[model samples]
Target: MATWSDFENAEPEMAEAGKKLLYQFGVGLAFLATVRKDGAPRLHPICPTVVNGRLYALIVDSHKRNDLRRDGRYALHTFPPVDVDDEFLVMGRAKLIEDPEVAEMVRKDQVARGMTSTNDELAFEFGIERAMHAKYPGGHGTWPPKYSIWKER
Candidate 1:
């Protein structure tokens, strides 16, 4: 859990640094998650997304999608290298969102980035729940990752 005071008083530059690092490397690593039915964790490589001031992913024809449709609960993890032996890990929950407009926006973004097929496979959005971050190499200092709680309208 995070407190408002923590994020509120954070240096603007520091927060930007952390976000840049995460966003830069968020695309490569597999997002580890668990579905509701079996409660078994799974992993999927995702293209990092920042939409409507929130983070999301356009999941296409994945079991993750099926799980999200059934239950809008999941977790994600990613590691981005900062330097030799210096890296950061992000863990968080994800919620599914289904909307035609949002789906179209995501599709356009994906196509622009050469990620998704132009077909009609788009169906869901994984909205962030709570994000936790930790840095490696011990002496790097600390600033807790920002966690976002989703409220679907």
Candidate 2:
């Protein structure tokens, strides 16, 4: 597994495009897909955090959180645009951030941004396995948008 910083250092363009798509709305908004306990898929809206060259998401006490805790494997897709057919995706494994300092920093940032108030959230740093982006020049008219992909070696 490669950290976001590692991926960024290796494939700066791809990583930047992915990051742009993820935060296109000036905030973290994406569709997070995780495996449920029954081997099914669960999708949820998530606001991801990118700081200090790391991708993090705070999971509250909910089914989505449980899914991530039980199975770290996940797929995150950028939120759809109203007038564009472009897409960005990332697949990775999430590991809990056990370091108190790291977690506290993230928490403080979130609070400063008015994202969260309490520290009861679980912070997980994503380890990138693959990242990709598709750009459509003519919306759905384009059969296959130009695809750019990067995989950790």
Model 2 over residues 13-32: C-alpha lDDT tens digits?
87888887887776677899
lDDT tens digits by residue: candidate 1, 1-153: 222123223333333444555466433333546574778766676665545544556776768777777766666555555553233233334555557787677667656655656465644444432344444434345444344332212
Instruction: Pull out the clashing pairs in model 1.
Output: none
Residue 110 shift from truth in candidate 1, angstroms: 2.7
What's the TM for model 1? 0.62
Question: In order, what is each prediction's RMSD in angstroms?
Answer: 6.2, 1.7
Model 1 segments beyond 4 Å from truth? 1-18, 25-30, 82-95, 137-153
lDDT of each: 0.50, 0.84
TM-score of each: 0.62, 0.91
Best by the TM-score measure: 2
